[model samples]
Target chain A: MKKGIILVLVIVGLLVTTSFASVEKPVMGISLISYYNPFFLALRDGAKEALDEIGGTLLESDSQQDVAKQLAAIESFISRGVDVILLNAVDSEGVIPAVELANEAGIPVVTVDNDASGGDVEALVASDNVLAGKLCGEYLVEKLKNEDGVPAGNVVVLDALPVTGVLNRLQGFYSVIQEYPQIRIVSTQNAQGNRTDGFEVMENILLANSNIDAVFAINDPSALGALEAIDAAGRQDEMFIVSVDGAKEAMEAIKNGTSFEMTAAQLPTLIGKIGVETAMKVLNGEEVDRFIPVDVFSVTPENVDEFLEMATF
Target chain B: MNPFVSFLYKNKVTVAFVIIFIFFAIFIPNFLSLNNLMSVGKQIAVNGIIATGMTFVIITGGIDLSVGSLLAVAGVFCAMLVKSGVNSIVVILLTIGLGILIGLTNGLVITKLKIAPFITTLAMLSILRAFALGMSGGRSVSGLGDTFRFIGRGEIFSIPFPLFIMIVVFIIFGFILAQTKFGTHVYAIGENEDTSNILGLKVDKNKIIVYCISGGLAALASIIQTARLNSGQPLTGEGAELDAIAAVVIGGTDLNGGYGRIIGTVFGVAIMGMLTNGLILLNISFYYQLAVKGLVILFAVGVSRKK
Candidate 1:
């Protein structure tokens, strides 16, 4: 009984120190997609950075890439009396029940990076993934025009989730790549955004195809996976590798010459910071923009050293 | 006539292996090359190590679905420690200890709780998987030390270190399965648990030991896998339990328990290793590989049923 009382007092103390004029105590729940990805780790780091700035605690849960667990984490947050909740959903459509449950608990919800397909979220902050993809496609086009003078060759693509934001990025990248008359994709596979599988699947690809010109990975992990497999096959110098998601590790890969070409960077840290900031506004009885657009740019060997931290998008 | 059937039944694994070999050699040139065989052995090392422990448990009529999950946990822990700049020796010992805990838990759950090994290990499968995934924050613990990676990728006189480990584990397990009184107790329990119990075989104790052994072996697989990839991606061993069990069954273990052979599971593991590399070399589609794997499992089980 004493411990419980002390915990409650500590909770009250955390809430009373809010940056905004003294107001009702608030708590926030952070439920994220697969935490194994460094991208999500950066997202969590950003959220912690925000918590430090805003006097709130984060109850973080990983969905292990499962939609059901993502929902359960949200419901858990609601039951814990958090004033606000942030979601990085694995499946955007399947989170309605938990979102509605949080709303009933009088806690507003913000969707970060991954948009909630059906949830009535207070705010959604993420990169313009389409533009990010477009940027990669544009970069590839320029590379082909300047170096090769043509876009005719064998290419392998590793697409991310078959849904939503990732699908949007794929579509945008595909839309641009289609303009190249001679560029042909010899093979495309799914690694589910996991590095190990990416490595294995890419190994199989490398074994089967000896004449590949380039590889397009959906994210930095997959790109790195391809690079590892290529390195294993002793073909690191032969194939050009490009990807989205300029994560810090991927930038390091670029700087080290392990990875070829570039990545379309997404600011995971900024997403975390702004998602929390927007949640605070909603908590303060103020309306915030539903969709906040963050900038996306290409990171290559030329600028990787100077932009490693920012690469953790 | 019955002798012929029995003979065919007794050497089913060998027959299947031969058949696959003949088919691959005929269809794909260079399929039987020495380099390819080395690659196959190296590939089989992962599941071969896991199967060593599993054979012990199966000999006692028990199952271990948590083997794959335990592998993931051990790999993740070992990798995380290494990446955090911990000494390699400490990281290796810590990983081995974690494996022991997983095995101990499996044993306690089965023996103390008197739970069916199937369901108990099955639940463990999901739990340990979830726990490992959570611990790593769902990220890959990468950038391991080169010497640490040597266990998986190192070669001893042109032989992959992992394959070498698999052979050593097999020799050790083979000794236990063939020589020790515990081996006899395990087979006795599998053959007739009630009879073994009445015979003062300490059936429950034997059962617990087998589970622990299985966990330890699974951890060994994780070590090899981690060394191979040089990173402990939390999700690395997903769906691998099915492969381990499949290899055990394919090698000629009775699913209903009572009999298991370490050499048999090695052949089973070898066959699987051959299949993956074979298919990749032949450039078979992913869908075909999945179908062929299922068909192979069915064939192995069907052959075992004839016994």
Candidate 2:
């Protein structure tokens, strides 16, 4: 009779342990490619905030701008038995091994902004980067018209390279400016979307092209670079500048008159937050849409105050 | 006064630096202005401090390519801890510890693993750069407290804190070089490693120390860089080693190693900083500026090349 009582207690203990384990929140793994650029920083914060609200733990790793490191981060996530994984791939095709490992572990994977193609992630949460580019070009076309005067004169482009940001932004420029044949594109150089490099490259263009009427940069960093080059050349008032990525610094530039024109603002934090939320939904056995493309808006001096107050540098 | 003038005669480049400073003061708008002067002085603190440590390694006839990448890596780890509510000083200490470990690895890999310093450091460079970028998801670590930024942007008695740190670093390292036995060994090794080894110099140990110094200095640089920008850029200090090497070489260090001084590099780096500032003022294009920088380094090295 004593042995029977002991068995009963043991079974009860086992049942309690199993139930408590199930009651614990599911864990998620997230890998970020860098924290140097402000856009990704916002995304990191947004994702962290969302994960906190849902009671899910986030296992964060930084790839530090290396493809191999990104792959390692994913592998580390899988080994720890995370329920789901979020990846911001450094290179589009280099993340397959980690993605495959997660797939084998029966863990769902959601790719964040800047996807790793050919990997079967459950969903991709990213900005409509291409469409955002279109908006930028459209904005530029509208801004460059001088009292119904056609957009004309030599133009310079501070383009991003070998990526969606540059390609889409280029499309945006072409979309609106193609109609204005007189707006000649004098030069397009890859500044890699960096402010410091942007200044240097733009300085070269300014020296070579004396009649530049406008500049189209792929991102805010490049736009700021152009502003520096212009200022350095003592030609700040002669140019109309437009770019993408409405980072907080760009707003300051707009306010201070250091940089002229507009930026297509990508929803960096929103995409990050929604990505975490959607990943949770998937973990709960609910269906999430295959793609979430965040929208962007043109930020100008007219509405700059609101964004300035709301933005984080 | 005669001794001072003769001392100035010995370092013609440093004299030239002073002359240029005076020229800018007279000709350039806001050249001697407190803010502009502070900017250049502040910029030097990170590079100069790190270069001071690097001077030891270069004098010992070895090169360290991993300083830039290591800086980013160490910065990321420390910044991560800070964001998670760790005490800043504790984080800094832990980071210094991590830096020492990296430095030890560099020393071991070159001395024990039989890897050439160039190849070993180059590999570390690539690996560390990737590791830094991946750790932070290509984002920057931001919203660091004021105390941290103070290291980069603060001032002591109207002088930038970065400059203050840099001057202190120079004096400390300079004293070691001019007075310490270890400093003598460093020069002896660089001047003739095989002979020094035969003479019973603990070549392996000194090698390790030199690299350790390099790594620790790199950590210091990243910390200042993070404080200055108020964020740790996983991509911070990219291609920075080139500039450092140029400084050392143009300051009259023999590429064959063991024949340079920290003070010489100080002048070399100052020349670079001055040139950059000057070109910016001169409306030089970025591409042209790059060309000019390259040319100046080439010219300086050419002029200083042992005939």
Candidate 3:
């Protein structure tokens, strides 16, 4: 038994070592909230590209939206002695301890997309969420005005309350929509930031509010979900949908000229690229801004084709 | 040679764990480091706790899919209580109580209504998840205080607090499973429920208790998770039932019931935890990691099956 165990161990050791020989490089650890979403996947791709340009090794973990797993990944990053860390927080407040651990290790932490609530973060690289919301609000207003000759309609919001980013988008949308007294928000319900919830919530909203003229979803998945509900109810032409996140599906829907009129496209790739760049700067002892905001654009039928041509994720 | 091969087959789960550990220790940088191991322990604690409860239910020839949803609801409930300035002790007790209550309901429904455990728990899963979402407004309940965080984050003697909790739970459950009359009854029921019923074993009562243990332990896991995240999230623990089930199965626990050990489950959880930690250290892509995990699980379970 002992000899057999010894033989197996030797073979495994040899195979593993040869296959996973470590190379000396400036290692960067990235803990994504979850890679299931295309947006976060694109963000990871952007970071990978940036790291490759500098010949740095990038170690990435998908936290699967569980704060415990995310913390474990961050702790693993710290143990590996990575030069820097890029964090996409699953929960802004829940991630404080992880950021603090990075701080203690003297490793710079650059938060991408989602910001942490505590700890001495070197920088935060994220899209201007407020601007994304504002862009959506503007597009909604313009589209409503063009369709009805007045920026007046009963709108329902498929919102996600857990995400600070989504909340900021809502705030920006509310800031714009609240101004037009003629445009009333008939109902606002939480979609929990996914397509299934978005569809279910919108279905209930539709049952209650029959005269809904427009819907604003917090993200692409939810927007498409709301679109599904609208189409199911045979109210596609009666209402138009707008959302944030220039996801490929959202772009396709826009190009097809479905009820999904427009989406405020946040450049997750840019946020990721800037995140790596900022982490490098912090590593080099160079001064860096605490908050770096990427731009958001409006993806409408007029420009959806152009955006789709350049989309990588 | 035949005897040796039979022994290998019998102990395949341990062999798999040992091989994986050796591989990571040799190739993955810092895989054997104290900090890395501690983190892995912490990572597996939540699943480990739930798997402990799952073992009982599985040993009784049953499954509990609602553990995940029960965990989420318990977490959100605890978080709300903490936010409302409830004492940490009271919050923990109430959260665990809620878990037990849910488990009791699951047990009663399956027994009294003559429904299968699978169907009963599956329906409970949807109901509990919706309840959690409604209670938390589909948002994460954040800002749980430092005292509550200690349950997940605080350490005793340099080990993670959650890891400590997992170890204590394993010991208690392991002892119960191996040394108690209830444990013997569980195995008898799993082996042949009808025969055990004829033997006057209080079959229905035991089954209900087994499910209660599963639900209560699931709630216990939620406390650690909620404390670690420092928030109560309605969406947390989504698909966690699968992870716990995976661990229990990987530990060589017979899914059909009557044949498993807590020690095997422990090794199972360890193997999974090491795989996740080691893969990240090796810089493997997330997409490939999922594939590797699935294959390893299948290989471990497949090799251990009776010839």
What is candidate 2's lDDT per residue for A1-313, written digit by digit as tens? 9999898768656633432222135566677778666677778778888877866666676566754445545544554456788888775644554576578768898988877665478888987767767776676666567766665677787886657657866876687778888778899998878888999999899889888878888888888888888988998877878888888888888877664678777777887898888887887788877887877777888888888776754
Against the native complex, each candidate's DockQ, computed on alpha carbons, is: 0.01, 0.02, 0.45
Tell me the whole-model lDDT of each prediction, alpha carbons only: 0.77, 0.75, 0.88
What is the lDDT for A158 in model 1?
Answer: 86
Runs in model 1 lying further than 4 Å from the true structure: A1-313, B2-6
By DockQ, the best candidate is: 3
- The top-ranked prediction according to TM-score is 3
Model 3 misplaced stretches (Cα beyond 4 Å): A1-24, A136-163, A170-243, A253-262, A300-302
What TM-score does prediction 3 earn? 0.87
Compared with the true structure, the alpha-carbon lDDT of candidate 1 equals 0.77
Please give, for residues B5-48, the per-residue lDDT of candidate 3 as tens digits. Answer: 88888888888998999888877777888878888899899999
Ranking by DockQ: 3, 2, 1
The per-residue C-alpha lDDT of model 3 at residue B46 equals 90
Model 1, A220-259: lDDT tens per residue?
8888887888998898877788888787778888888774
TM-score of chain A of each: 0.82, 0.87, 0.87
**RMSD to truth, every model:** 23.9, 22.0, 4.4
